[model samples]
Target: MTEINENALAKMREVVPESQIHYLTKAVSRDDKNKLGCEQKNGRNVSADGIFCGGYHPKSFHVAYWGHADLTARLLEADPEWNWEPLSVDDRGLPAFDQNGGLWMRLTVGGVTRLGYGDSQGKTGPNAIKEAIGDGLRNAAMRFGAGLELWSKSDLRSTQETDDAREWLVEAQAAADVPAIREIWQQARAAGADVDTLDKITILAQERMEGGA
Candidate 1:
């Protein structure tokens, strides 16, 4: 079982934005400490659970499954512009985290979920439901204890798309400069977007302010 270090969690929160923070917990399977639906911990052979906390993207609101190696490879193969790494796999070669485990944190900005994966095989089951509940509970706990922002399914982007967008934006902004900013501004102005769109522009501007460009 992985250790849940409160100090590490606190530090993680500090690094992550309060607006992007989310929380979820899941039960691990005993039959497979790493697989879904196998009970293995707490002497009851209950599934091992994890607490996931992070941001939600505006595109694909689901980030957990997108982290899967299979999914990441497919996505990257399809688009070399993607700037994220696949989730690490355990000794069994399964993705480090699956839909059945925990609600992994996903950061999303400008319609993308940052660092996460989605399972394309669609092997969801009991563990999937358990994971969802865990995610909800963890999110509630964080919102109650830390005053972080929380959004419903519809309000946030689907986890998968959101995960991709966030990472791409991060990478793109990293290589951005005054010229890039000018382009973004030009595009936004040309589109005559609403306040929210401009707000995203502002956020991107702030990132540039902090040397993201």
Candidate 2:
């Protein structure tokens, strides 16, 4: 990755700040929030069967691409000379199909300004104009090379729990009975087995029925 410019870095902090993750306290009830620290909710905070650990926290979004407006204002402030232009638009207008457009930014560096481009597409309805605009802008900002580093942080998804969920799935599927499998399916979902894994079990059933095996 091209190193982010020091000036750009400074501007990024002012623009896209890190997400504030407030650590949980007893007042923050377990069912009330999406996230709670591992310390307090240690015993059965997620699954009753112990397959899900709500505290496992996989990838965290420190500075998620804020919607269209904030990003534009932020980038502009960072570089007063910076400019954005719409590069392309979908030929079939909105309501006919989703809006897809390309946007480019002109950012001035030390003494020079360079162009960066981004592409964005969004579903046909709602605040799509705004949505498409933001998508394109964030993509361009990525090339501007400042706040994009927020994505560099990685999280170690809890492997043991994931494996345990898989094991329960295999054993449940072994029963080859609809009711038994259904029970496991619900349990797995509550336990936080990912959708992909859960979908595989459904796929397995479909394959067996189609093959008549």
Candidate number of the best TM-score: 2
Cα deviation of 191 in candidate 1 (Å)?
A: 11
* lDDT of each residue in 1-213, candidate 1, tens digit only: 433334423432332243333333322111223322222222222211122232221111122211133323333333333332224556985435554554333422222334433332333676664444334333432332222323343235335334644543454465457567556654543332223444455577777778745
Q: Which candidate number maximizes lDDT?
A: 2
* lDDT of candidate 2 over 47-127, digit per residue (tens): 333222234432121222345556666666676655554443346532122233444545453233455554435344446
What Cα-based lDDT does every candidate model obtain? 0.37, 0.49
User: What are the runs in model 1 whose C-alpha is more than 4 Å off?
Assistant: 1-157, 184-201, 206-213
Candidate 2 Cα errors over 4 Å, as ranges = 1-10, 13-15, 19-64, 67-69, 88-122, 153-191, 210-213
- For candidate 2, the TM-score is 0.48
Candidate 1 local Cα displacement, residue 76, angstroms: 48
